[model samples]
Target: MIGVSHIVVDWGTSSFRLWALDRAGAVLAERRSAQGLAASAAEGFETVLETHLAALAIPEGVPVMMCGMVGSRAGWVEAAYVDTPAGLDRLTEKAALVPSARRPVRILPGIAQRGAQGSDVMRGEETQLLPLIREGFAGLACLPGTHSKWVRVEEGKVSGFATFMTGELFHLLRSASIVAPAVDGAATVDPRSEAFARGVGDGLAAPDMLGSELFRLRAAWLLEGAGPDAALARLSGLLLGAEFAGAARFGGRGPVALIASGPAAALYRAALAQAGVATVTTHDAEDCVRAGLHAAAVSAFRLERMSA
Candidate 1:
């Protein structure tokens, strides 16, 4: 146990989740709100949080730590990236703890890195990856989110990761792209056919053709006369398949841990199976974040207390 007061915040672009934990990192109270980085833009961050904290009746001066897109350029403040292959020790910053009657609040900095090919960065996912990597296999952790991350773990530390906007791209193609217009209003999806596997196979063969692959969906409808739902599943299959292939190169026959749930996990499972790679999935989203935050908080508190 670090101390009596415990607070953890996973503030992102779309939503904000706060947890009040006991010294042992057990949740006492938790709340979720729409006051994400985007929502707070108009009123500013402090106001966004004040409203939520007031409603929760949280005391002041509680030690608080945060993760997520809230640390991005569009977020309250730029926390900077800790780079890939990083560990809990790389997390730095005692962000101006929001002042309150009970405690101080601080935001942790994300991570960033640059190499010859290019530079990559992350905001909050690092927090979630921390404990997961430490708990299971310690080498090369892949986290699938809106921006799927291929993180390299060395000695139980997050060394670095690359983020591909796979999920968002899937949404855009399905909702806005011409190739996926047929699937815009889909209600259900069926991935139990050869078409699904075919898309996966094609996508893996040419991962970079994702943008152009949308044309296949449209062509399938016009030429092959495929249905809307089938087209949607095909597109989904293509994206997942490509990502799986690209990410597999990083796995290096090493164990890979997937941290996600719902339908997304299923799709990933199918793709991995098709590719003949073994993986493990943890379904609890909040639990993953909590475990991550627990590791982060423990490390930070120790470092802070040590220097003190």
Candidate 2:
């Protein structure tokens, strides 16, 4: 409260994280909650935002900067997408303003690929691309999540990108499809599991045979009594493998980089290794998002410089 310069937020579909920071980006205070876009939509976006603001004792005049689904068309404000082959700087310039708030609030814009052949849109993940551009990162970057995004950066701009529903598909298949019984009581997926490796091989080897491979996991449970752990790992590997299979064909200009913060880091790393991609540089997901959010804050607001 005393020395805070601005507040930065990462408001995703099911999670909310806010930080009070000085001009130098050192966090002064922090808050995290389950009041993501969905919960905030029902509870009232401003109301949800205010509750946290008040809890943090965030003073009036401290502008708030946000990224993620909070800026989605279905969230607080529709922070339109900046089409591909665009500079990352467009994110800060095109940020949408949130109206009628206690203080100035803005949400960063997402990126869109409008090509007739491979049209796609992504929100929230673009913030993760800022650091890459800032560092002169040129090549492909794989950011894994519910909807994993593989982006191509060239000449300090996002040239092209692709998205995969690997996580969502894995969840749907395990809970709602015929593969439920096979993974119902499954233990955590072992990165080094033999079944996992086999599944990865199965996917990369036969991309067109994915449906059959998924069904085979269930069949293994029925006849050979394949355990839950193996079943889950096998399924995860299959999905990730297929995702990479398609992504690999996206045409690479340089080595791959994996930006992840959680278990996804290891999972994606292992999957990449299995797919014969062994020269990836790994960056911490938190670092990239924080850098991106701060950069957006700087661009959208005239951040006050702290005194020496």
Best by TM-score: 2
The prediction achieving the highest lDDT against the true structure is 2
Tell me the lDDT of candidate 1.
0.70
RMSD of each: 3.6, 1.8
Q: Which parts of model 1 are misplaced by more than 4 Å?
A: 1-4, 92-102, 188-194, 208-212, 252-254, 280-283, 298-308
- The CA-based lDDT of model 2 is what? 0.84
The models' CA-based lDDT, in order, is: 0.70, 0.84
lDDT of 2 by residue, 1-308 (tens): 68888888899999998888888788888889998777799999888888888898888878888889988878888889999887877889998898877788999988899866389878877788888788888888888999999888899998788899998999899999999999999877888888888888887777788999899989999999988899999999888878878887775323688889888888878878777785458988877887788888877786754233
Looking at candidate 1, the ten consecutive residues that score lowest on lDDT are 94-103
State residue 63's C-alpha deviation in candidate 1, in Å. Answer: 2.1
List runs of model 2 lying over 4 Å from the truth: 252-254, 305-308
Worst 10 residues of 2 by lDDT: 299-308
lDDT tens digits, residue span 1-308, model 1: 23335568898878889887766678877888887676688888777776666676765645567788776778766666665556666674433333442444556777777786259887777777766666655666566778988777777676666787888988888877787666766765455656677788878888889777878788877887788877877787888778877776677234567666557666766666776766755445567787777666665555345323
